[model samples]
Target: MKTALCIGGTRFVGRHTVEELLAHDYDVTTFTRGIHDDPFADRAGVSHIPGDRTDRDALESAAAEVAPSVVIDFCAYHPREVKTATEVFVDARYVYVSSGSAYARPDVPMRENGTPIHDCTPEQATDDSAESYGPRKAEGDRAVAVAAVEGVEAMAVRPMLVYGPHDYTERFAYWVGRVAEYDRVLVPGDGGSLLHRSYVEDVARALRIVAEEGEPGEAYNVADRNAFSLSESLELVADALDTEVDVVGASERELAAVGLEPADFPLYTPRPMLVSTEKLASLGWESTPKADAVAATATAHVENGRDGAENGPARKDEEKVLEAMEETSA
Candidate 1:
């Protein structure tokens, strides 16, 4: 069995990717801070190593001990983080999780070869400050791209807005939940703005594929054909819930006036965030349709009450921190 090391495998896309890898029968080892609880804790074929990736000695020790064939780094945000990981896992293949924000002001249909938002060079370390999420990740991408040792290669996987079960952010869930309640939905920019909607599970699967089959030194955009308007997404949610909903057109500034930013902008914003998945598609990957994916998400939302809609805290990170604290105490 092939051995794979996963960082940040206890939540979100990382968690899903771990499950998918296990389903494919790969021997998996996960590294985390022992923060979150995983349902797979009792699974027969899995192993978890508790440590902080930011701690160079701890992470390096884990890497030297595990020596996995592939290291799927889902948690790294800074270029220094990548450097720390690479120093410890020099012999393994690397697959870094990046964001589509790395694209430099992308055109409507963003391609992998699109204008880069930042130069991909190791000399330029990514700034990990919260505001520079995109640029930092891009720098990490470059760091990994240039630092791989002989017989070891690295690839980067960038994904856009990901929505699905257990999504604590509730960004997508907020829109879906509002529509389900039969409320007047706000549509940003006449619902003509297009953004790539990727189901989290599909995005997870794409990450696994890129780790296993993607070309080294290249970045792959893991998005589906479901480029949609904010209006279309809301309609899908309403249809799934069999609810009558109203959508109001609002500009970015208008949404901002209501305490909503483009980041918080609901399903109908018209800014195009298209990405060409030809690179990933060439690897024979398939994704669920947008409507079906959202329907599934709606079902999960109702069942699990993820996001603040269910009366949880506003930010997913807050909930995660609480969960982590609980785990630490336990």
Candidate 2:
């Protein structure tokens, strides 16, 4: 059986990737700092190596132990980390998880080669703030390219706004929670906001496919085939919950009247964020159906008791905004 090593497999996409690898009949080993619980501690054909990824020696030790055929990296935030990992796993197939944020332009459909990559300054590469995240990821993609030039089997997969079960980011869960708990859900900007999303399972599958069949030095974008508007997404959640909700759309003026901005709402993008998955589709990748994916996510959200209270404005704040909108309409 082929052996696969994951750099950050204890949570979110990493966790799903491990399960995906196992389903494909690969022996999986996850290298994490051992702070979080390991869901695969007892799973068959899986192992764990506890160490900090930033530590070169730790990574080298794991490399020597597993000799993985493919290495999927999920936690390399800094460009230097990606550079170091490419060197350490020089002999293995390396796939770095990049983000759509790496695209410098706000093109309607960001293409892998068509869009310019955000340039990363030395300062930005090391900075951990949200502002620098795209630059750092763009630089990491450059690192993968460099490794490929040196004959390493390195590739990058860029996913946009991944959501599903065990999503620690809780961005999508915030919406799911609102649909599940409230009768009148507040949606920003006429509820026509579009933010492309990739289901966690599909992303995990993309990682494996890119490692096995993708060309070195190329980056592939991963997202659901059909992008959903913010209002449609809420409707999907409501369907998943076997209930109905009145999706209340609040205009920018309405939101501002309550001392709120559209940005305050989670996943509220003033401009539509989209990326083309055609390249990945060329490699034989297919996304999960939107309705089915939302169902699974809703089920998991309830099971995990993830209210997503921290992701967006509090319920009281939302109520205030809703009340203000009602008064103006009256």
Cα TM-score of candidate 2: 0.98
- Residue lDDT tens for model 2, 26-126: 99999999999999999999999999999999999999999999999999999999999999999899999999999999898999999999999999988
Best by lDDT: 2
What is each predicted model's overall lDDT from 0 to 1? 0.74, 0.94
Q: Kindly list the per-residue Cα lDDT of model 1 for residues 1-330, writing each as its tens digit.
A: 888899888888887888888988888889998778876698877798988888988877777778788899988988888766766777777888888878877677778776666654443354445557777887877766776533447888888878788777777777766676535655545666677878888888888888788887788888776576677777888887778777655555554443554554443333577888877888988889878887888878867765345432233433343344346569
Model 1 CA deviation exceeding 4 Å by range: 119-127, 148-151, 251-270, 307-330
**Over the full model, what C-alpha lDDT does candidate 1 score relative to the true structure?**
0.74
At residue 113, give the lDDT of candidate 1: 76
Inter-residue clash pairs, candidate 2? none
